[model samples]
Target: MGEPSHEATTAPQEDLSSEATTTARGNHAEELTGAAAMFANDRASQHLGITVDDHGPGWAQCSMTITDIMANGHEITHGGYIFLFADTTFAMACNYPGSTTVASGGDIDFLKPTYVGDTLVARGKEIVKQGRSGIYDIEVTRGEEIVAVYRGRSRTLPARKPTTSDAAAPPVPTSP
Candidate 1:
């Protein structure tokens, strides 16, 4: 393989704190709508170690570190972890503004299988927003090599209840 394809993003990288803040507070998994629940299926990524930097309507980026737990018997990083990392970024990008959006489908391009200790970063950017649906391009990279690529589709719904900082706008990109 060449490299894993990723969900592309224009997100600026930052020094993420290990102590995760409650990114979503209003509804836990059980309390979420179906769409929200699906989008929220990214708990493992967040629980393990995923950082989401969302800039509403414009960009979203998430970073994940490859650890021993992420490796297979042969020592190559498990592809599931990579997929989750990319998908998690899509969730944050779609859920920015704290709205409920569900992905309809996606196309992913995997470039290569990575190994432990590699810092994989996934970034997502809005491609276009129509009446109630939007498309996003997601990219996953390790340092500089592109590893994975993903395209996500999300369907938005009117808010049932908003999360804390629901209306927050996306921050502009600074640097990785």
Candidate 2:
């Protein structure tokens, strides 16, 4: 992987399909969410509009838009979509492989007003984790300027239940 372009108003890093992406970010393809990850999407995005970008921890990034469902009375953007960007990326970073995480709480600062046709991106990095709780430093960046920074927490699950795959791998045939 080479280095990802550090730019403002950037498009989705092309088709990021290469296992060895041309980005400084190390490959975490194994952690990529398929249909298995919880919260695959919310009813708001219309279509599934969330994805992980080529980034490393304690750093992560995601992109979402100001859809009709996400616009406010003024036909501008809303806070929920902003939270969506933040929370989604945070989930990817915390729920990684080892941690089964849920959002404990968060604080978001809205720096500037957003409008329709704006493509917003959110980024999060795990700053610290201990026991069953961790703090994530988050940034909601539009273009190059950061519109918001969220401090979020992931509360660990006591004992997570088996996923479909975990339970569907048929038991080994018993030999008499």
TM-score of each: 0.65, 0.66
RMSD (Cα, Å) of candidate 1? 10.0
The CA lDDT of each predicted structure is 0.63, 0.61
lDDT by residue (1-176, candidate 1, tens digit) is: 11222322222232222111122233333233232333344446656577654334435667777888989888988877887777777766666443567778877888988987788877788788887798988889988889999988888877676555544644433335
* Top of the candidates by lDDT: 1
Q: Whose TM-score is greatest here?
A: 2
Error (Å) of candidate 1 at residue 65 is: 0.6
Q: Candidate 2: which stretches are off by over 4 Å? A: 1-36, 39-48, 55-58, 161-169, 172-176
Local error of candidate 2 at 108, Å?
A: 1.0
- Point out the worst 10-residue segment of candidate 2 by lDDT: 20-29
Kindly provide the TM-score of model 1 when superposed on the true structure, using C-alpha atoms: 0.65
